[model samples]
Target: TETLTNRDNHNYDDVMDFYLMDNGPNVTGYVNKGFDVHLDDFYNNLTADKKSSFFLTALHESQHTMGLQHPFESGFDEWVHNSKIDSTGSSIMSYNERDFNGNNDLRIYDLAVLHYRYGVNPNARSGDDTYGFKNFEQNNADGGVYIWDGAGVDTFDASNEKDGNGVYVNLTAGSRIYRGGNTIPNWTNKHLGLQEINGS
Candidate 1:
């Protein structure tokens, strides 16, 4: 009979919350000066094509980190207007893919941008130097390359390049010389500022 009388009901609830604590103020002073480049597992195992692609990707990303922007990023018309330098045949920053589809080295405009950004390396290859296809078939197969020489009387020896298509050598500063072949890209090789060129 006493159990029939009920007391006032009471309820209790429990709640939990989480908050991320700030460690400290953000770091400063290295705004555009430093960057981290990350390559995934694919980089560890590269085929011939992948190697070229990896090289291009590394150069392209490094240029971005160094404050370089693609000409077509904003100025679409300008990129088309300056097709010479705004194309992949000339600039690595260019999105336009040309005959040099699998270019392994930096193009002319890429070299220009780097020089403009960091200034020329005055101490590069100051001694007498000779550049040529050590192994013609192998070099041609590997694709284009650029030779940067700094204040030296250099020579371009094409003795080993027995390609009957003929070799065109330009011994001027920042000019490219290439062999005539339907197989070779338009701008396949260049030796910047060479004093001598022989062995045709």
Candidate 2:
């Protein structure tokens, strides 16, 4: 921990977890500082959005490690990117408020950007091939019902009801699941069970 904070020519090349004293009130953390991977100190102050904010910042910084830049920021070939969602710009990369749906996630548009830039990465530690992204209901006015996970495009007919009234059984290819219904029992693969889906 002490070694990451003290950055220099010798240790700047290593992964770092830093504590920033000057980030904005809304800003929680950063992945890389001066090209060194770092996580900021802003995570400690996440009051209502603690869990969401933590993962959001971690993912944001990880994108940096993957050579991804904010859509609003400049990109390769010295091109400027205008990728902020006009409706609700609260993705992990943006300064807007981080959302807390089933999971605080990157915007659908941002995931597309990553796919466009680096292509799909299969065999994740969890979830789909697209960086462990899974289908969770997004509760925003933007009508963003999906998380644009690293996997290819997948859509389903479902509802956001906690009672499991609108759950979709059909999924597209590359959509790794963690849950399922009673009939579709596959524990190692599916994280959600059917009884839970029915709200029993």
Candidate 3:
């Protein structure tokens, strides 16, 4: 099916290194298959950090072979030029470098696109807003120490609360304060805690 061959037997050059080829194609210096990856001077000429950077570039280029076009490469030249540079920060096809300074980390939108395109999600939770926690559970209800419900005017009352700790108060919507298995009244918004308000 596919073969990865080095351009030359020498191991010290920083120019051309390896090439990939399918059965009927000519061998070349660039990676071919979407999965075939190579780090430029991966082991010799490049530093460890540079190796990682090239690896990410290979990953992005591989996506190109998978029938996906760069977001900026689409025919709308004006739109492409005018688009926010940060927009590409999360996209692999954004022509941006994949280093620490770059928004090198993938986002949820990237995962969704990958899922839709290749049936695989690379960074499934890339842009999750859960503060990296899988799920949240409430330990109190009413005015006790708990996540603030969006619509309430309650203060942290350590005297009436269990464990003698002050609660975190919230004034937005859908702040859930639970006790045992029951939910507190006035906090029944399905979108609660899910929708983030601007400047709030």
Candidate 4:
């Protein structure tokens, strides 16, 4: 995976997006965390009672990496907003973020795909992983993602890639993180990066 550059970015065949803490390639979108909208902003973007942006972003991008493009991105732009309000079509691959409804989860079909990819068959429905200060994220058909910080701190780094203490925790796709009794830190996708328009 090559590092992402402001002048060298395209959705196809791109695998990674790395940045510095400065005015570098700041990011906001999933699959690519910029200096401006990195991971911590994932949580910061949510409402008080509905703060699941981080987890959802993680899952969203994970789904993308798993070959599940946004419903519209699947060469089906006609389904973008065919109905009134937002209709995600009830698939995690849908862009209907408003449907997050605090329980934004991977649909059954998606889980089926992931299970097959991971060599594990899923049941009808594995239980729901609710969002709260716990910072729980879905791992696989079994366990979950865990992020632990000493000093009783419960926070992520400004970039949401590391712990507040500057330690890198393993956050892989198809997993979730939980901060039990810890200051879930703030991450930043807070930098400014220019977008590359077609034929620019």
> Highest lDDT, which number?
1
Cα displacement (Å) at residue 108, model 2:
1.0
Q: Estimate each model's TM-score.
A: 0.44, 0.38, 0.38, 0.36
Q: Write the per-residue lDDT of candidate 3 for residues 103-197, one digit (tens) a residue.
A: 34443334433333333332432342222111222111111222222222334333444643334433343343333333354422211111111
Give the alpha carbon lDDT tens digit for every residue of 45-121 in model 2. Answer: 76765756567667777666544455344321122232233212434455444334444555654554444344445
lDDT for 49 (candidate 1): 68
Candidate 1 has a TM-score of: 0.44
Which has the higher lDDT value, candidate number 2 or candidate number 4?
Answer: 2
Best by TM-score: 1
Please give the distance, in angstroms, between residue 116's alpha carbon in candidate 1 and its true position after superposition: 1.5
- Please report the TM-score between candidate 2 and the true structure: 0.38
Q: Please list all clashing residue pairs in model 3, or write none if there are none.
A: 140-178, 145-167, 149-175, 150-171, 150-172, 150-173
Candidate closer to the true structure by TM-score (higher is better), 2 or 4? 2
3 or 4: which has the higher TM-score? 3
After aligning candidate 2 to the native by TM-score, how far in Å is the CA of 137 from where it should be?
A: 7.0
Instruction: Pick out the ten consecutive residues of candidate 3 with the lowest summed lDDT.
Output: 190-199
Weakest 10 consecutive residues of candidate 1 by summed lDDT: 191-200
In terms of TM-score, how similar is model 4 to the real structure?
A: 0.36
